[model samples]
Target: MSEQGFKYSILASGSSGNCFYLESPEKKILVDAGLSGKKITSLLAEIDRKPEDLDAIFVTHEHKDHIHGVGVLARKYHLDIYANQETWQAMEGHLGKLDLDQKHIFQMGKTKTFGDLDIESFGVSHDAVAPQFYRFMKDNKSFVILTDTGYVSDRMAGIVENADAYLIESNHDIEILRSGAYPWSLKQRILSDLGHLSNEDGAETMIRTLGNRTKKIYLGHLSKENNIKELAHMTMVNQLAQADLAVGHDFKVYDTSPDQATPLTNI
Candidate 1:
């Protein structure tokens, strides 16, 4: 990867599971490990990386699809795992045994430095106990990973604004979800403030958060049943057009997948 900026890839992203690989000049890390250990291992190989190459695993929440393989990877690779105190408490049972030094607790809304990168976690409106999203900075470039939140509050937007790249969730099409096969209670939950962002919600967030510094946007954590890549991309395109922004020229948008990894991108 280029030494000028950060290199990253979405290993897998969807309701089934989500994992992201990020490499700085001095550190290689996994933002989440939601897939099986075997699956995550294979995905890392696709990017010419191995589990042992990772310096740490920073978890966003305790959701199964976001943490299924965290324990396994940490144990197998002897990698450090970092999360907020409440998230540690909620996910401890799922992680099994670990050396005392393997676990690192960080406070919310605080920036922690590892090597050349600075990472900050802030609260998000999600059902999981103390769920949060992350913003990572390396020198002048910044990247934000915002997902699993039903709505983006002004505070959250302010925190993540002007990032060079974003991996934000454009989870579902509201109409399709509203009229789909899911039960009413489930639909209600998905649409609630503590759930996931709809396509429209995601677009609005981009409009508010994108700035002169923003360039690449990855729409992730899509719903397999209620969303398709084309539809989600179109929604973002249309909404962004209304703001006088051109998709390919103003900024590039990439759709992430659950079954595969995006090419390693530099920002």
Candidate 2:
């Protein structure tokens, strides 16, 4: 409750690319830099910052959309990049070359520090090797970022339930994804246990996971093909509404954009 300074911005989100900008009192960092270095830095400039100002980049998993710009940004800015041991193995070759000193491997479930902030990674079910989600905390307040998982496990829900704010995946609507023009294999992949969250699944997860203290949420990683912003938004809103957890009164939900940066948020 005493957390003073924490900010998060989704520089971009979706299947095409993903990136996040984060700041703590004594450290400036990014969660992922899936965008090109040029695009990432340009987005940074929009917030009146620069790549050289970052202290580190924390990667979630090995997917290209989560790491496309990691190597370039790290090499250009001479910044440290943190990833779990398995993730490092899965993504190292794909990231091109990185200086030895720039690699910082963290143990999953153990806490690591950056100035006033503390970060913890937890396993999440996904197609990639060692895919995961993260919790970032300072003082008693916390923010959580979870994406690219097919379903929300009880354990995963428990881990993130009490966060002050959350950036969670609301990837597609079930009917839309199933009935869309995508091929059968692609549709099955998206609907599988290792695929992505459907809009209804997202709503159910939030109903189970969101605490009374949790106030703000940004629905992210939406699919441009099988989903649209308003559908995802109204889906969750209506679900929560049925649960009597009214939006705006109980909490606020923001739909993240795939093509542009979402508004800066504080936690």
Candidate 3:
């Protein structure tokens, strides 16, 4: 990886809303605009970026938790909104409130190049209108952002296998989610094959697929009500320890806060 290559940051990552910022000196992009426009703006400001500085916005799905501020942000800043046809159609009603000129539909699997960065969207197992995850590469550096998937399929595993870093969902602890205050239906939904990934699942998946290049992981999309940071980390640690993997030595786990921005990392 070139020292001058692209940089990425997790502005805010959790159940309430998820957003990430990726930038090179010349171009900038946002992945998922789940937060409100004002909040997103404030986050961008904290990172020394303006909404107008973004060249495009890529949405992973149509869920409100992923596209809440997409329309407003794109419309207000006149930035391009790139999504698959299905995702765009699913969000058409909400998107119509924004300027039509900003909408750009490109099928998943088609690489979208933004100057120094190459981006590819791939399918993820999530309950939404065409949900997808993203792989980003610049220079010799690359990473895959995989989250909100209920289970990690073989295909998804293949995509994540070659990455240097992974921003994955460690949504909840299995025991916690099963016995928490949530109703049966909600609990069932979360445990379903199309719901979120549990902390144990995340650890096992990482242990099974992690390569030497995969040195850093940001455990994202945690359920604030059902999962606690220490518990989630400890569960993952126990799971990986059985496989002879140590957290800080093998690969570090960074717990993303629901109410704060996570620090930038080098892959």
Against the true structure, what is each candidate's TM-score? Answer: 0.98, 0.96, 0.93
Per-residue CA lDDT of candidate 3, range 1-267, in tens?
Answer: 445657778888889999988877667889999989999888877767788878898899998888889888887888888899999889878764766678788787678777778787888888988888888887767778888889998877876684677787889988888888999999988899999999988887887777877677778889988788888788777777788876688677777765566664545
| Model 2: lowest-lDDT 10 consecutive positions | 257-266
The TM-score-based order of candidates, best leading, equals 1, 2, 3
Q: Number of clashes in every candidate structure?
A: 0, 0, 0
Give the winner by TM-score: 2 or 3: 2
What's the lDDT for residue 242 in model 3?
86
Give residue 206's lDDT in candidate 1 (0 to 100): 96
Per-residue accuracy of model 2 over 1-267 as CA lDDT, tens digit each: 225858878888888888988887688999888889999888887777789999999999989899999999999989898989999999999888888999999777778877899888888878988887789998778888988999998988888887888888899988888889999999999899899988888888888888877898889889999998899999988998898886788789987775577666677
Ranking by lDDT: 1, 2, 3
- Candidate 1: pairs in clash: none
Error of 2 at 109 (Å): 1.9
Candidate 3 whole-model C-alpha lDDT, 0 to 1? 0.82
Predictions in order: lDDT: 0.93, 0.86, 0.82
Candidate 2 wrongly placed segments (more than 4 Å): 1-3
